[model samples]
Target chain A: MDPDPTIAAIARWSGIAPPNEAARIGLADNAALITEIEAMRGTMGFEEEPSDFKAALRDCREPTP
Target chain B: MNAPVAVTDLASLSMTEAADAFATGEVAATALVEACLARIDAHDAVVNSVIRLDREAALEAAAAADAARAAGRPLGKLAGVPMMHKDMYYRAGRVSSCGSKIRRDFIPGVTATVLERLDAAGAIDMGTLNMAEFAQNPTGHNAHFGHCHNPWDPAYCTGGSSSGSGAGVAARFFYAALGSDTGGSIRLPATLCGVTGLKGTQTRVSRAGVMPLSFSCDNVGPLVRTARDAARFMAVTAGHDPRDPTSAREPVPDYEAALTGDIRGLRIAVCETFFLDGADAPVVAAFEAALDALRARGAVVTRISASSMRAINAYTAMVSRVEGAAIHANWMREHPGDYAIHLSARLFGGYAFPAHLYVEALSRRGPLLRQFVAEALTGHDIVATPTLKTRVPTLAETDIDADPANWSRFMAVSANTRPFNYLGLPTISIPCGFDDRGLPIGLQLAGRPFAEATVLKAADAFQRETGWHCKAPAL
Candidate 1:
């Protein structure tokens, strides 16, 4: 359940280490958030790409003359 | 040859009123600028809303505007209006500290497109206002320039990132200010400070030359006195910009003209779900009253179910944080110590999120948007909610930097507003009523994507029926 090691490892990979204990706590919370978001991935389709967001906005717009 | 308008009366005029007054030669631009300067000089110390006061440059611009009027030259829509902006909007060769210590002296070579548009509209830029550091935190807590105090009650928090823009507008220091909303930055302050704020659909406004927090979610908008003022501000600033290719090509309608104050048959949906969870009694009372007023204005209100909000909220945080982390990766590597402790910590966590998860969050955005629209706006012209789920908290209670334990209250300040950012919809916040503590409360209205006109029309109609927006702080 300790996210410190993973966070530290990722920090090293990203070229920035956690600056303090508060950062580690924040990272732990982020880890929880990521888990929650990942669980929702089942609702997404394999065909969808990040760029589809803009098209979605356009499609949902209220049509004007 | 007419007598000059009194400084107090000029300072109190809304942006649209000032513009109209100037157009008809009822007041000179110099007098308007001077009125704003006098208010800032007298009250800004208590509000702590101003970061820089460009008194000389503003007067020069005002004089030019007055001269143009005397010559009977053409004028822009917002001609002769005086305003300030959140310090993150860049002006060529002028310092835009972005409410951070690291960029305390960073000046950009290019002016923000919104500033250029505001200038072309003949609005005088008085100066820049305070904000959350790098426009990150939701609560108006800045360890660098000092937290922006609510004009209603200095002890209360001005919901931020757009802190000073909200406070300054409320205190009548200026008529309007540009505030960027990544995740409720503009709406939070608008609600907390009792002003009007609008965030068009994502990409509705250009971001070129402005500081970036989350590339996908960041929005450029205005904080003003009433929805009518917001409509005018948007008419000036919302449109495509060549410099910002991401800016939407959607035609910018005459937002002010759309404010006919006739909203008969407007279908407004109210979700009795996540947006209202754990709502404060006072907040609920004020929100219900606002709904009653809107109902009195011939708008149809319906209760709807929204089950996609939790996922929407989570994905929004993921995408914004990851993008923000990527933007600040270099600085975090070289000078993490330069940031406030809480900001640096938040950025540090951003670097830890897995890349796949980031992609997953973005990938789901389209599906989520479609679902939300179908569920919330399929039969509705607008979705209505209380801008904040709880009563306004004081600075002492929400300052996470002082005590990390304050994080929950701090984060909750933005809970109701953040989902709209992820939805990428056009949304607005207007003063609804005051809490038992005499602080302002707000009602948020959202509409279909690219429907800024619809949103403003509804808000303007509500303002006509109710006088909440007219009641200013005693500052």
Candidate 2:
């Protein structure tokens, strides 16, 4: 089986997030993070992402145990 | 008569030698323990490596071991060896400051699994060692407790966040000690202190009850006088733990058996791109010499294909930052001024790690870890590289507030070591040589997932042949 959605998404993003961020926020805010994620997706070529990846983010953002 | 009874001399006295002498009624554990306590009294004033010296308990433990042997009870290999634990690890009812005022009086009822394992193995618990506050900073300086000076050169850094483990082990106050690495804490200090450090594969050793740094990256391992000593420690401390899900369920190997030092046909790869670049002349020279030494000792060494190191470094940055930030997020928000200024931005910054980036960095480690385990080390038993890339810098030089060049170089030099933590692989750093300043430099050998035996074999062989790891800084 393939890796979990959130993990795979992280893998995708791990390739793209530029090291130039002044801070993590700056890193996230800079188009660099998204750009890298998108680029990695293009390289391996994932057309659609798992819905759970987005849901996991919502849970992490909310932190509801 | 006894070389002034230095800690270095004591540590240089092998655990095997000491244990044998003690068993044969030649030397008493009480005598060795007293020697360490006396040395701590004399040189610790200069090193400041030990934060809390538990004399009463240490003597009691020593006396008990002597009693056990006298009673004809077969003792463990590390019987009567004196050691310390980094303050980040909880000692029942003792305050584990994590080097910050935030938890100054915070004590735990339970002890760390590694410490429990050490106790079971028959090591004398000398006391708690110093560290970078909250295991956040890699440099040894602590804003709250005070800086732990390098034993080789008091002015130079001992490296952190395992500052005291490195220094205490180096100075001989203890034969071996425990250090945790989130992002190169154990290896950095091991290299800087000129000792043997094993950052056992993540989850290879239990992490239950230790202070958290980065949950994903953090691991408990030995910082010792030699890899053999480290292996002795690993043999006892390793095993599946019901308390920590991350702890491996695999059976612990015969670390002593792995130490025969015969790597005749072992496939060992030397990483060129990230490890070899941007290193100082002295470090580069020592590393090349180490490669030569290993080759002469009969092992294959070749450069493996490396991806963009920046990508790996970037991943380490986010994963550690986000997780570390998460750990301290509460304490930091509660008391901002309580933390070292250098760690402040890094921890709080984890929250700012766009939710996507944090998850992305966390997720990214999966494939790479599996692939490296499956392919890169397919034929290779172990991989070799410089543990660190620069000569040891001074604590005064790395104040983050004081020297940007020193801080950046400090961060960059660790590029060789941190990826293993990111990949959750076992890595060992063995002292390779000394620079002109007399500080120790280390060479890192990383092994496949759960292949700690190979890592131990390579390190133990290199150490036995070179004797670099046995050399101690005159305190």
Candidate 3:
């Protein structure tokens, strides 16, 4: 696959260069992870925020003995 | 009064045992410190576990502890026990190299809150231990500091990024050590080195004054010889610190008191899915035997399905990678050559992810954790797995720096332990059995979020029935 253009754009806009060919190849696993996360795009509700994880942990805790 | 335990045996005692001996005047703090120092002096050259050894300071502190005891003054919970933490935990005015050359001379102005708590409990600070540079890698390969060798066999990998904590504790250099876990840093080392390590629920312990690799995934915990030691260590360190506002405010329970050794009727689920997929035969045999041991203790074991693990693993990698890249952005731009080649490459990939994808990874954490708990843990009090899906690997085989072909084995080292990081549940790894190569295998026990006591209870009960944790490496 061609190097993901969006990654290059983000790296350029952020003032950091993209990984070299070897390093980019090393990221093949991460590329698969990105694809997996991308597959779940619409599953999350609009109101959901990262902080909800803390609440979820508390809510799911085993009842205090 | 009972006869005093031999000084040569002091280093072999568990953290709680050593502390209790000190409390009852069976052994002086000085003797315990001396015993640990002697062990390090004898074996650390082979293990390469210590980055620094505060020999004089530890001796002085032990003397002070003895004086306090002689004066009938109150002693802290861990009074007189020796510990060495991963170098990332800062002690004011001391250099915490964080296993990286870039920070070799960087000194912090404050001591880590966990260290302060450990001091209050009377644990001696022997020095800092080696780790993956910047805690970036899963295997214990540090370019600045030499690789931490497994005490069992010097040629094998110690597992990382909490390399020294695992190897040192297994080598009997100290009673316990602090290890930071993000993507199996603590548990992997614990598994590979054959000891007990606990990563409490996310934010269960304070991160103040500790190094940060990932804000969301980082957890501070202990690597020790036994589950009871882990329980006691957690009791002293697991609570909110005002300095770390992100730390959970959940009431810390009496973790030690929870080890009643009666695990009868406790439900355990073994996910016959992602955790066991591609598991080597020896690892599977060891893991099955571990489940049988737990079953003999009257614990119920059920094979269950967990479909969310793939997502959990993916999100975990995405979030930690993005956060780690952002954390190291300025450093990478300025001192790019200072980091190891493998580390730079890993962070380079981190810089490639889109911003929204990072957000999506974070945003989906709650939902995935909810799904996991519902599917795998709703009926089970604990979920069990092989801490490492394969038997221990030799350093030569997993050294990515020497050859990039080693990447798959290096990354696979943390496969069984990484998903739990994203789920943010309380998990512990204890020695189950050894592999065909005589390397140790670990049985992992993960419980509901914040249920550290239940997790500790089960692990302690298992340790009571098995001699795995007591089998020290022949250094």
Candidate 4:
């Protein structure tokens, strides 16, 4: 079993750069991050290449009409 | 009743008084500047708070502000009001250490957007205050430059990345100081050190020229003596900066005007769950007292379940770890030797995690925010809680090198406030009262997105009704 693959998976999905190779196991890369991303309740798997970017709203002041 | 050299608590002294004294053949900017510099000279050695100082440059700026007043051309809102920028903000020709040794000696030729505005307002920069390396840790401890000690109790921690900003203001070294809030950097310090600090909603203030922590979570604000002072500083710094790609095009509102009203009819939320759960006694008591006082003062207060906060950890776990890792990826790969052992190891391990977790974390955030907005704040104006569960932890307790529980305690106290950063809300941590040990515990007042005015008004009213902000460290 490749611990490195699991380590890479946690960093890719969770975004917290784990401390080192070993820390990816628990330290900064805890169990919550180790769980499969799609395993969470209703998340569709990667094969379902969903369309749009989860666009966040940016506040912009448009001139009054 | 006034001592001859009473260190003027810049929060207590009206800017007008300082300016008047300076102009009316009474006080000199050099005198005030020297006193502040003297503060850095005497106390900072023990506090170990200042990361960078330009003594010669500060003196020259003070003299210039004094001489400009003599020239009679009107100066800015904070004319001759000595101020310092948090180390995250780049000041050209100054080493703006983001508390990371990687850029420890790297000086910039460009000034941070907010620092430039503060300078334009005639505020003199004294130095760059210390923060957690990479603005990651909530504790004020920096392994490289040493930790920033709490002024209230030098043995304890001053909540961090903006730890020095909080400590500097609470110790009354400068009139005002700038800080960044990502995962509650500004507010944690304010709460720990007993000062007023603000965290603007996303893009409410410019982030240009400041080092990045979590791009989506980052905001620039102030730690000052009063919310009014924070507002005054925000008014000058919140305008659109062409240098910032994400900066809002909105006109900056007069935040000072937001402070003039009483919070008599405002609908404030008293959190029932996350903020209230697993709590410390004195902090809860002080927070309740503050809430009761607000109620007595005619503000309508209701206890609401803060389910939104539950999602905070998930959001933070998703965004910051990723962004923080991204910012340091190149550095982590190349000069891994530069990072403090704990931080480098932490970031390295964080980067090793699956990318899917990050995307899933992001996916969770949208729904989490929606639930929070619906359940916690339908018609509410703001949410309030003790800024931290407990008072400042002693260095013996919070030192990463000491006991493992210390680092755990440091992370636990910061958990309650990180949710607000994830949602990108404006929050102010104001000193409600001191603990039995005479150390300060803060009450965090957070409002809806773009509700900076409401939050400032509520904080200003609380300050008006209390004297906590008026108290300064004896040191």
Residue lDDT tens for model 4, B1-475: 1123344543345343454456554566777788788777878877777877878888998888878878887778777877776788987887877887887888988888888888888888888888888788888878888888999988888998798888988876777888888888899999989999999877788888888888878889999888877777888889678899787665777777777657778888887887877777888899999998788767999888864564455547667877787787777767777777557655654565457756755665545555566666666788888899876677667665444444456567687778887777778999999888888999899876666777888898888788888887877
**Alpha-carbon deviation at B83 in model 4, angstroms:** 1.0
Fnat of candidate 3, please? 0.46
DockQ of each: 0.60, 0.06, 0.47, 0.21
Q: Which stretches of candidate 4 lie over 4 Å from their true place?
A: A1-29, A32-40, A43-65, B1-27, B363-367, B403-405
On DockQ, the stronger of 1 and 4 is: 1
Model 4 chain B weakest lDDT span, ten residues long: B1-10
In candidate 3 the C-alpha lDDT for residue B344 amounts to 81
Candidate that beats the other on lDDT, 1 or 2, i.e. the better one:
1
Give the poorly placed runs of model 3, Cα more than 4 Å off: A1-7, A18-22, A34-51, B1-8
Candidate 3 overall Cα lDDT vs. reference?
Answer: 0.89
- How far in Å is the alpha carbon of B55 misplaced in model 1? 0.6
Cα-based lDDT at residue B279, candidate 2: 81
Q: What is the C-alpha RMSD of each candidate to the true structure, in Å?
A: 2.5, 8.2, 2.3, 4.3
State in Å the error of residue B103, model 3.
0.2
Q: Please state the error at residue B184 of candidate 4 in Å.
A: 0.6
Could you tell me the lDDT of residue B340 within candidate 2? 64
Superposed model 2: Cα runs more than 4 Å off: A1-65, B1-11, B308-310, B403-407
Q: Of the candidates shown, which would achieve the greatest lDDT relative to the real structure?
A: 3
**TM-scores, in order shown?**
0.96, 0.87, 0.96, 0.88
lDDT tens readout by residue for model 2, B1-475: 0112334444457555555556666666887798788778888888888988999989998999888888989877678878888997887888888877788888898898888878777888888888988887777888888899999989998889999999888887877888999889999999998888899877788899899888888889989877777777888898899989867676788887878788777778876766777788998899888888888789888778656344555566668877876666556545766666666644544554566656666655655554555545656778788887778877776775454334454455456777878777789998999998888899998876667777888887887678797686787
Where in model 1 is the C-alpha error above 4 Å? A1-3, A31-35, A38-41, A44-51, A63-65, B1-8
Q: Which candidate is the best by DockQ?
A: 1
* C-alpha lDDT values of all predictions: 0.89, 0.74, 0.89, 0.74
Q: State fnat for each of the candidate structures.
A: 0.68, 0.03, 0.46, 0.16
CAPRI-style class, candidate 1: medium
